[model samples]
Target: MTQALVDGTVIRGHGVASGHASDSPYPAGTIAMQQPYFAALGLDLTGLYLATINLDIQPAQWRLLQADYTFRALRWTDLHPPEDFSFIHCQLLWQAQRYAGYIYYPHPATKIQHFQSPRMLELVLPWIATISYGARARLIYRAEQIQIEPAALL
Candidate 1:
């Protein structure tokens, strides 16, 4: 479904994964649709979560972690999402995710924005949070020219 546009592009990776942690205190993928923005575009986002899968082996677990590192951060209130974390207490809703991803460059033709490292991941609390979370800006995979579709004109 078509919703709002942040800046110009919509975060497109939501609802793509279905593997959510079943036994976690905070509901898995609970913050899927909290797009609190002050933009003109209106959004009707559906609740998206990580797809479920089994971790029966070692290599499988590693692959899952890699995907989660890039895919999971697309669902947060900041520029970057955490990739790694060590939980101290489950009750405080305090968790961490590390950031690692690709960023596209600014070409003379397309003029897309360039992504920078050391991005930001917002916190639920105001202060005293030492964790850093942000999307590791990367070049668009394949580096193809983007064409604006007709549907976006409306």
Candidate 2:
């Protein structure tokens, strides 16, 4: 039941709640909370897209990747998050384009009530508007780097 990453397709996520709460599509709180962490790790979030690109991966495929990636939840306050709150950094590829970003793990509270599929992958990038729904994309792990390309479909 595991689908190949190369065969994966990108779907519209309606964007994360954090993004919708702000003027821009990007998630302000989530990004703000993670900024210090990224800074401490010497990673820069300024160059990346602040919103998430939803990926529709098969359950089996998601399980396979979950086994390999580390899942960490960011809980700054007790308020129930409107979307997934966990994430892992990785690379992605789509239409011959490459990107570096993280795969967000939607919060269980939000997923059970909001998402239609259990096999959901959220990509948080600096240039998320590049890709639109129904685009073909792939997630790759090479040299510990995660790159996604064709960030915007249009």
| Stretches of model 2 off by over 4 angstroms after superposition | 1-4, 21-29, 32-44, 64-73, 81-86, 106-116, 142-154
Model 1, span 1-154: residue lDDT tens: 1211111111212221221445433343423323322011232222311221111111111101111111222223343343221101001122333222212111122211222111111111122133222322111211122212233232
Kindly report which residue stretches of model 1 are placed more than 4 angstroms away from their true locations once superposed: 1-25, 28-50, 58-81, 84-154
Q: How well does model 1 score by local distance difference test?
A: 0.21
Candidate 2 residue-wise lDDT, 1-154, digit = tens: 2322434678766544345653443356455565666456455567866666777765323422342233245443345443334456656786577787776655565544345445566676657556777877777543233222333321
Q: What TM-score quantifies how close candidate 1 is to the native fold?
A: 0.18
TM-score of each: 0.18, 0.58
